[model samples]
Target: MTNLLLALIYLAFISLGLPDSLLGSAWPEIYPGFGVPVSYAGIISMIISLGTITSSLLSDRIISRLGTGKVTAISGLLTALAILGFALAPNFWVLCACAIPYGLGAGSVDVALNNYVALHFKSTHMNWLHCSWGIGATIGPYVMGIALSGGGSWQSGYWYVSCIQLSITAILFLSLPLWRRQEPEDYGANTEESPGSDASSAHPRPLKLSQVVWIKGVKEVMTCFFCYSVMEQTTGVWGGTYLKLFKGMDAAAAAAFAGMLFLGVTLGRAASGFLSIRYSDQQLIRLGMILTAGGVLLLLMPGPAIVTVCGLMTIGLGCSPMYPAMIHATPQIFGREHSRAIIGVQMASFNVGMFVMPPLFGLIAQHLSVGFLPVYLALSLGIFALMQRRLASLYV
Candidate 1:
């Protein structure tokens, strides 16, 4: 029964992750149809991240009040509504307006579900859970590509994706019985912590924003995460447009290529999890960063289609393990009791970087050549590698 329930939850969570993944690929197509400029598209993306940041920051309070299962359901419904609104939106403003609720839904589910899985499941399950995200991310663009290839409008693509979300919501609702019946142990609660302890610590520590712990080696991990977030979000969000504008691919083909990038991430994530058990997290993270840097350099080449795809895949592989490895290492350095808040804070910083970097890339692409993207991405990757040496000592 426990296994069945978990399987169902995993499916629902993956479904939840699909929209964000698809948006990156589909936005270039959809935004133009709505008569928005590339700069405005970047703004829309920033707004979505802002909403995510807000939701994530406030999630502990919301989850405490609402409970994880209820929050998950509400988030799913809101997401579905947002998608429907996006589908029917007649103007760019309406689409941007829809992103508010959409971002809230996405961020809430992401924080809540990841927390839940981390608390309840084993380390291996973390990799599998994220792999599910990779799966959704992979499927989203491919599905959008298929819809666009069939001459369907972006609105039609959104509507179809919403249906998938709604189905996931229903499955989650049906499995609520399992979630309700399970003991706290089923979810990864430490037997040692008192029932009220988590709640007691839930209050925001007087925002000592400047007093953040700057332990040795911690800076390196943070830098790696920051750099990786910038690169991953920038590439994932803009890669489709890059392919279309610079590489001369059409909407559908570009999306398919984007899907390939996510597929590589999916494979890399699963591989990373298995390898982490055998090797040090520090070693894996360092190796991944090096590979990512190499991959970014590959993108700088004026290569054949196959070579370009391989470069994107290499980028995906390098990116795949960084997040999980970072999260895993956080507890080891900071201790488990404080790990959640620290991770949340780290994620906020990462999002800040994610929010700032991509739009700048878009703006730069407007002024310079889109070819400059690989150079910027490569620079970030190199910075991450340099930073990881400092981080390795801290985690060890």
Candidate 2:
């Protein structure tokens, strides 16, 4: 039963990850078809994230009323439908309309699964569970690249991904009983009395940022995550277009390069759990920020295709461990229950960064040069690293 439940959870994550990978890779090809400017693509990307932000705010309450299994099922269906919408969308407006449900479904699954894993699974499982997202993300671009290389349309790639999601949705429905039948002890009072009890108590009560320990550390973490998210999404959302416009890469070649970025992220995240076990979270985070900054610097260099790919990969590696480390470290300082609330607020910050920076970068690219965008990424990451000490102390 445990194994089945874990598998279902992994499927849920895969569903969440596939769209980002596919859309990011295929954006250059699809964007022009909709007859919109490149800058509008960034705004369209935010629509999905905006929906996610709204869903994250309501996830706790929704989960409590509907139960995790039901919510997962509903999200799965919504995602499956949204993928189909993306495939069939006729215009920019239709694509933007599809983003609404896509974001809601993705956000709900993300928060619900994270909360469920933290509450019920061990630390090792938490690490593995997140790695599942990397797996799906990696697959998303790879699949899209193959389809486009075969002379398939962008819509065809989405159709293929939608089928993968539907398959996972079937497995989740089959395994619903295992997830729903939680042991009484799992939710009993004894678990609440544990050292991290205060964290849980923070949840049912209204949110107060003051209740969080390590206010300085929280700020640092937030800044780091915010900067990283903006940089990551900016690249993911715009990299394909840049490749097409500046590098003169064809759709298939561009998608392949984009896949390489996600592949780098996958390899990085897959190893994060093992690395965190060996190093302190603070050390790991510091290293990640440094690597991310270094990667951005590499991107700024005038170089060959190998150098460019290497730079993007380095960026992916730098980003891979930060999210999990931030999440896992939170409970060590804030307690388990409060972790969700803290993360929710943190995610809000992340969304705000994602919402603001991509379009801004797009505008900059339009007015100036694509090469200049990496400088902004470097600056954001450098600031994040400089402030890591303050974030670390928040836990202390």
Question: Which segments of model 2 are wrong by more than 4 Å?
Answer: 25-40, 88-92, 120-124, 142-156, 183-219, 237-259, 300-305
Q: Each prediction's TM-score against the native?
A: 0.80, 0.81
Clashing pairs in 2: 199-338, 200-337, 214-394, 217-391
lDDT of 2 by residue, 1-396 (tens): 656677778778877777776776788898788877766776667788898888776665666567678778888888888899989988888888988998888776676677666556544556666778877777888889888999999999999998988887887777667766752223332343122333234335434545543443566667776887776777776676666666666877775686556566777777776776677666777778888877777777775655666777888888877776666666566555555556665666678788888878888888987767678787887777776666655663
Query: Looking at candidate 2, what is the lDDT of residue 375?
Result: 80
At residue 228, give the lDDT of candidate 2: 73
Candidate 1 lDDT by residue in tens digits, 269-308: 8987788667766677777777777777777777565566
RMSD of each: 4.5, 4.1
Query: After superposition, which runs of candidate 1 have C-alpha atoms over 4 Å from their true positions?
Result: 24-39, 145-153, 180-222, 237-260, 300-308, 366-374, 393-396
- Taken over the whole model, the C-alpha lDDT of each candidate is 0.71, 0.71
